[model samples]
Target: MAIVVNLDVMMAKRKMSLNELSEKVDITLANLSILKTGKARAVRFSTLEAICKVLECQPGDILEYVAD
Candidate 1:
């Protein structure tokens, strides 16, 4: 199974930067980078909610499932 995070794609579509998102989401750059790079093992619902609100996107827009 493979789960892909389209964070960078959404950020680009929204014309937002890493640092900007970090500040808006109140997430550390390191942690956000981990999530953005699809290295995160998990993410809290609240964190996800904040991201969605800040980016004006849905969780489905940032997440994808692939059969491997």
Candidate 2:
């Protein structure tokens, strides 16, 4: 996948647990895990916004584009 999800990195940087982020973002643990593990095929902008809001980061902090 050219688009990499760096959710785990941000979470670690912020010292937040998956459980805590899920609660703050009001998302399911399984879904967040999928995103964190880079298994999610798509993410809604609203969801991404909520995550960024909770993590105190911009979208670039969580998502990265790498050329193949």
For each candidate in the order shown, give its overall lDDT on alpha carbons.
Answer: 0.96, 0.97
**Between which residue pairs do clashes occur in model 1?**
none
How would you encode candidate 1's per-residue C-alpha lDDT over 1-68 as one tens digit per residue?
A: 29999999999999999999999999999999999999999999999999999999999999899889
What is candidate 2's lDDT per residue for 4-63, written digit by digit as tens?
Answer: 999999999999999999999999999999999999999999999999999999999999
TM for candidate 2 is 0.97
TM-score of each predicted structure versus truth: 0.96, 0.97
Q: Give the worst 10-residue stretch by lDDT in candidate 2.
A: 1-10
Q: Backbone clashes in each candidate structure, one number apiece?
A: 0, 0
As a whole number from 0 to 100, the lDDT of residue 55 in candidate 2 is 95
Task: Give candidate 1's root-mean-square deviation (CA, Å).
Answer: 0.8
**RMSD (Å) of each candidate, 1 decimal:** 0.8, 0.5
